[model samples]
Target: MSIATSVPHPAVETARRFARSSRTHDGLRCPNAAFDAWFARQRLVNRFEVTPVPFSRLRGWRFRSDTGDLVHDSGGFFRIEGLHVTGDLGEWSQPVINQREIGILGILVKEFDGVPHLLMQAKMEPGNINTVQLSPTVQATRSNHTGVHGGRAVPYLEYFTDGSRSRTIVDVPQSEQGSWFLRKRNRNMLVEVVEDVPDHPDFRWLTLGQVNRLLRRDNVVNMDARSVLSCIPCLPDEPAGGAYGRALHEALRPGSWSLRSDAEVLHWISDLKSRRELTQQRIPLSDAAPWRRGPAAITHPTGRYFRVLAAEIAAANREVPGWTQPLLEPAGRGVVAFLTRRINGVLHILLNARSEAGCMDVLELAPTVQYQPCNHPGRPPRFSRAAEDPARLVYDTLQSEEGGRFMYAESHYRIAEVDDACPLDVPEDFTWVTPRQVMDLLRHGYYLNMQARSLFAALLALA
Candidate 1:
């Protein structure tokens, strides 16, 4: 709770006019300047640059054995000016490397059959500055666990179509925004940064979920890699006092941050696990947290369709081929919903949270439902596309035109899993702005669909 107690890194704060309206919390809104700049929305688009060399447009169809899933080009050298570099979402940037050095370098990534791979790596060498490497999209499989920590896991129930087998979900996928997440030719994704960080030049590689680690490492003063590069301070910003200075500052801040040591970090992690168990609430760093930035609900906008999730679908009928059946509903008004249902099949099945161009195939885990705010979204939604345009918590309980049940026309914000200097709480900057404040911000404004009086009068519940 007192982790961020000492602002180890300096923050650049300016007095900006506080908008009276808006419900999304500030901590949930943008990366904290005080916690070091982080771009939550970087992974939605291509992180690095590459020239397309379409081997063949829509090249026929289904792939064969040992072949890659994606057939795109891989030869271009653009600046690593975003998540393309350090994988920090939008603000993650990169230094331009030479064309020759930037060619794709195929590497054997751990993958199984029937999944796709997005292998990309950007490393800096003497002459190979900003050098990028990409690989043919290979099939992938989701990891066994999902969490930012390497400790014990809490168990949960998983029901399949054939019947229900109580399986303990020990391995929580430690997937951060920029963490290496891959989809199989069909099912879930695997995030591999936490498990692979130590190999990163000894803490040189920082995962999105490890923002807290980065701070702790810096404060430790010797356990981690400091972004040190001579003549390049902040990372070359522009025609003014740019990244050169800023980068230096970032790399060097912890030189005096905390008086902690490697022993202290070890002690913290060791004890932290016990503390987590004592509290039944899911810890801030578990797989359930989704603080990293990206589109809220990425569903295909083509039709009013319904589906049985990919992973669960596969489980239902792996003997046949790929994700196949079950109690699937139609997509109403295009309000795409991603459920985590258990699909019974041969071998294992994985359902992920990522969607490719609106088409989603994740397992829908219902029965245990946790509601989250739908924030800063990007997609032509079928039902609630404009839900988060304003800050208010818009909730309208109405009967569906074609239905027999009550539907909640609720406004949403992409709720992110946050863990940092402190435990997840309503940070001071935003706590003052309550539900009323949020209502005011969206009241009759541009992009805002409803006003306070009308919206409040129509709602049946408030979060």
Candidate 2:
């Protein structure tokens, strides 16, 4: 008999490195305390001002006389159009952002002292509440990177776009908020480099543990960064500290026992997709009923869901020093929670097969509860109360949505460990799955919604 040598795949080695980095909170390049001070200094030094302006006052944007769609003169960025969706629930029409172009949300990784550190940027978006937050290494739309905006070149873009410069660790396209953008997707990439990288004033190298720790804070890590970080394939090989940590670690292990097998979960998703019926049609913005356009904004009659408003922004740190664009402002803050429970000694999270007007597919796996308190008034969704219980709450933090498109939009993201009272048999639309299953599903696009992905990243932080 001939003996064969076992060799680990490159991706597996990369994941191991990431796992090691995740265990080290204080990076050699930038310690957590030093990062906090640098972030504060960046906020103070940069000049950022956002002023509300009327539609007529927009510099390069105007409403089409025929379709009444608010579009840019260059027709490169995004346009506010009307989307009519018809399904079993009912039929409705609303203004949705039509951004057909895909963007790049890439993070660069480099090894220092045998541990990996990610390159992060202190980016400022007009809609962020704090005016600045930690963003990805290169968060640029095709238009911005292609010079459609006629601004300065985006820094550190060559590492991701030009493949020869760095080795690809994880490169997958992921969906954004299904309800807000129309068929939107961004290329979420994590690239590792071997050569020395020049330092920029706004950029810093931090460990994966530091990034996860920042996730616990409110509006510190931006939406794009979280989405990309969730794609990193790293699960602790050994049991983590504490009871909850141990359970979470076990749940994330690939071959760990799960309530539902991989085949069963895929079948469930496919069955749901085949049975559900959704039809959407594009119409002019003026034809959207119950929504009126005013001098300053386009608002609904009762101002329930969201409204479209224009803003003039000036940021000294951005590629473009000044610009004018439209922003979607939600009525109120939203709640995105995941209900977790130890099933058969393993942790499992409850996910909902939620459908939205702008989803490319009819349904995507969403959080246990994704709703705006203002929109639902007295009628709260199921499992929300359990998730809000102070005693059962495991992790709770306020996170902002994509600041470039949404104005002051934030959600209270929570993870609660429910008691056995919450039974395993849930509604037809909801199902329980382990973290490993969720991570496996993430390898393919559109399986989990943006809110769920963000919560998954938060869950990993717990381990």
Candidate 3:
């Protein structure tokens, strides 16, 4: 047996290198002082525009004659279909995005002066509040990288597709918004390369710490970038900066004391999956009752949740110059928050085992409160009041959701420190777990919801 055939594997070393990168806040390639001007310049030079249009104006897309589902002519991108769900909550029918293809969201890494740096792109999407945001090196769907849209080749895609060119650090399939996307998932990947790579005006090399700092700002880091960053392994030696950071550091440290054991947490999720009765059946878009299709949009009668609308986009930096497609426009801004409390000197966040209509697993761990304010005008989800209180909030930012598929969808992500007034005895659907427990579950797929993962990425910045 040789060293190449070692049992523990070389991936462990890759993780250690990533850990070192996370500690380096400044990089040799791009200094912290110059990042802001570079990002602003990308936004100014991109020249992105989006115009709302009627469904009839959508090019290469149509509502199916038989099923009334919204689809593309090539049938490669994705489709807007109807899902009928009956679960413990209640019975309801809503519109969901049915994209079966597993797209790739990969980040390329390299050492600059012996410190690991990531390759990030300033990408534009039609639905983004800000037209351009920091994204992964490659964020392409199967239809995209395969050139089904007859567009330019995706830049730096070979690094992800060709295994021999780069070393794989992290690769796993992660779920999107279960409520909106029907059983949808994308491949989250991180790869390292030793060879010299060319740099383009749209791309920049950033340290993990620099990326973490950007996460603190609102709508600066895209959802795909945050999702991929959350997959990086948490090292025990990372610095703990502030008062809250100290608690979080202990929570993420291996073998930290927690209120619930690892087995108990797994058992809780497993028990919910087994006991929760949820029945989902695919139906034609025409059959989705109470949702009416008008000239401008397909919307619910009350117009509370979301609507399907069409948009014409023109981008100077995309694979293609312009295209017309359908987008999901949310009714109003949403609120997703995690309520945390210090128990026995370790911080634990309150998680709800939420079951969405499109979740592959019946349920996944979600933030304490994930709801739209417009849906319940006066009434709010439990714990939201405390989470939103100015005195308790440690982290609060208005972040945008996946902009490629959504139109101007923004959510207020918050992390609040609850005092003794909030009870430790949670409802049956909720549980208390440490940050390390959540990180452990995040290594696998379909365990934590997209909002939780986004919050986790923001949480890492606090440290």
Best by lDDT: 2
Backbone clashes in model 1 = 64
Off by over 4 Å in 2: 1-10
How does residue 68 of candidate 3 score in lDDT?
A: 93
Report the poorest 10 consecutive residues by lDDT, candidate 2: 1-10
lDDT agreement of model 1 with the native: 0.18
Residue pairs in candidate 2 whose N, alpha carbon or C atoms collide under 3 angstroms: none
lDDT of all the models against the reference? 0.18, 0.90, 0.88
TM per candidate: 0.20, 0.97, 0.96
lDDT of 1 at 269: 33
lDDT of 3 by residue, 146-201 (tens): 99999999999999999999988778899999889999999999898999999898
Ranking by lDDT: 2, 3, 1
Tell me how candidate 3 scores on lDDT.
0.88
Output the better candidate (2/3) by TM-score: 2
